[model samples]
Target: MSRFFSSRYANAEPYKPGEQPKGQTVVLKLNTNENPFPPSPRAIAAAAEAAGRVNIYNDHMCRDLKAAASEYFGLPAENIMFGNGSDENLDFAIRAFADDGFPLIFPDITYSFYETLAGLHSLPQVVVPLAEDFSLRLEDYRGLKGMVLIANPNAPTGLARSRAEMEAFIAEDPERLVLVDEAYVDFGNESCVPLVSKYDNLIVTMTFSKSRSMAGARLGISFACKELIDDMEIIRNSGNPYNVNSMTSAMGAAILQDDEYTRKNCAEICRVRGWFSGELRALGFNVLDSRTNFVLARTDKIGGKELYEALKARGILIRHFNQERIKDYNRISIGTEEQMKLLLENIKEVLK
Candidate 1:
């Protein structure tokens, strides 16, 4: 049995994603950062129309989705690569860019997935600490001892680095590959995609899982110089010829064309994110200044784990990390206005 599994994964400490309980019917699933709203009606219709696509294998190269994304971004099709989701793109990032000798560097408190990627690949890693405000120190990234990975509008904390600040770092050291995970870019802030035309070393990864509201779709992509795209394409071809199925290609393409849908939803989320923060503050919870579809907040009165368990018992599910610094806080995703009212109502009762 030991000989059957890949040596790399035999002892790999995989990323522990949030639980999806099926046994319970009274569940308010805010544990994962998913949109409460349905995906664009157009996309759902397209997927429905593509139901018979299972009979044939998808285009190994993802032609339709590539064209849609290229048109959306106003870039050449050759410059883009799509995956089952952005995590697939990130896995490609790990395999293509850095090796075991040159490990990746990221904020210690950032997305937990980075640590899992490093461990799975046996990549050497250097974990940098964020400033007291949970914001990244852009200046600290000037001289990368190795490849640097950053999640702008970073996860859990939701703080982001500005475009001017990112451009400054790129200007300082133009040699290293700077991979920017912009999964939350549409919610707020300018994207680094435009810079990819000029900077060959810049690669940005994005997903339809966030602003596009298609987490179940598992669609991810990256933009870079043709050279980087070509390199990743080789790795992709070696592994799965059709990483994204035909039906999903049609679905992703449909969603990409509906920019209005993604924008409208993001605007709603941004508005409600602020309102939810205010409501939490009124109830004496300290919420972080969030720019994404989620908020991080803490209560001075109770332990985070206690609050988390309490919320779960009440059929409301929010996230509480067991880590030292973040354990004091809960990362809650912004749902619809009505769902949020219920979440807030339950929290008030739980606190008492």
Candidate 2:
């Protein structure tokens, strides 16, 4: 608390990201939902080649990258927007739509970043709670008075609602803006990108960080009607004309060109998620059905915090939220088969 600190930021509570331990120790990290595999070889080559052009500013509009995404997703470049990451895109949405009067609406136990963004912007927030099984109830969101942000295949829980359900929700309020954060959509979840052209009020944000294994590169894309995308572009250019660097832009374009690479990785992750979930259940843990590359589980024998600490002590790292309803649960990212086997062995030892 600095004596000269501004009162505007007095109540700001920043989101705490997962731990990133940097050392020589080999840690089986399942805390952050990062891809265990490396990025595509072509993407790596493109990035390496683009490194030489670092002295020049990246294309402000990210034209080539947008064109590549357009080709891949079958959406026009006019309907696409790019940012530093999906977090930035989400922040842009909050700034563009949410206000003190309009407020921001989201799931009560969804991505924590939504709350942080709302707080940063001083926007009123309406957090609608999910059903008992953590599924979104369409009726609960029938008449939201503000911008709605839904994380498809939501973080921590990793549960997803179907596209039909989402379409119905979007149809409920055509005037209200609905932002779908699909950061984990590649992992066995249906994407709302196809609906962007159909609904003028819908904006879907995705990231290359999760499935593309480019968390370090920090590339994010948003899909919507041209008018909405133009508004987001205004916000983006007003802040930073070159939000994405050349290397990232080039690499992201290359990666999008080779969709098979990410799809293969996503399939593998989903397979591992299923296997890991079953293994956790066999160990007396209650695992939630997940569509993302992570699984949310809780054990009747041990508390989440206790298990989290125990796993960390044994050179493994998993996510544990200290929130009220989910404090007992741990969110574990799906790693390779060998890594998962090691995790299961460690869990058996801990339980014993």
Candidate 3:
């Protein structure tokens, strides 16, 4: 530990993100759950135009982006908030809502960022474990008395709870705030965005990184009751008022203007995911049913660490968590058909 660091942050354990390899070689990167396709041509054009306006500060209100989001989701501008990324939105939520007195509740096996955010804010947290099959049980969360955060079609596992189940969980405690991260919802899972209007306590977050193929742009969207959104706006304005860049804002709005582009890309990813899962299962791997663009699987023949190392040696990068209960599983993002075929061929060579 550095003696120069603040005492509060000295003991903090930061989240480890996927590796970003830099070299001349072509890397088959299926580690980070990013879209393998290019962004919409319209979005690219808009971003190129906005790049010329780099001298001026971006609109702090993100008015045009919110308007585009409103048209796409059928929600008003007052009900939405944009962030540099969904991580920033999640951070704002933790900072705005979580407290030492009222604990934060989330799944033990969901996104690792929740725990990191709680630690960063120094908020008490209650982690509910998922069922043996990695599915969430609403009964487990029935009587919790704190703000809730759940990643729909959860990361690493890529399994989604039904919208009815989520609604029931939200109805369980209307007074408490519930944050639903639908980062991968465009793949196949049912979204709780429509429920924001029905339940004032619900805050649904989405990201352009996944579906819109704009991970580099770092655009995130949040939907909630106008009151809750107002509170988040206060938090955002307090920090960097111009959180998103002009290029990102313009491109994000342009991408949202064409839903078909994202839908088509998501459909192809889902198709590839299903095919990859079947191939892995046929090879004696236990592939979990995934609605997102990634599959979590483990082989009885080889350990997760071993498979990860082998894939790395072959230049096929997938994710392997060293955490308990998940050490045996590897999370592989779905790429193009050619990429998947190459991965399969490499896996065959590696296993042999």
Could you estimate the TM-score for every candidate?
A: 0.97, 0.97, 0.98
User: Could you give candidate 3's per-residue lDDT for residues 1-352 as a string of tens digits?
Assistant: 6678787764367988998886735469999898999999999999999999999888989899888999989988888999999999998878888888778999989999999888877789999999999988868887788888999989989999889989988887887789999999998989999899899889999988998899888989899999899899889999999999999999999998888898899999999988889999999999999999899999888899999999998777999999898999999999999999999998888889
After superposition, which runs of candidate 1 have C-alpha atoms over 4 Å from their true positions? 1-4
Residue 116 displacement (Å), model 3:
0.9
Per-prediction count of colliding residue pairs?
A: 2, 0, 0
For 182-269, candidate 2 gives per-residue lDDT tens digits of 9999988889999998999899999999999999999999999999888888888789889899999999999998889988988998
The lDDT values for all models are 0.86, 0.89, 0.90
lDDT by residue for model 1 over 5-35, one digit each (tens)?
8886644688889878767665588878898
| Model 1: colliding residue pairs | 84-218, 85-218
TM-score of 2: 0.97
Better of 1 and 2 by TM-score: 2
Ranking according to lDDT, highest score first? 3, 2, 1
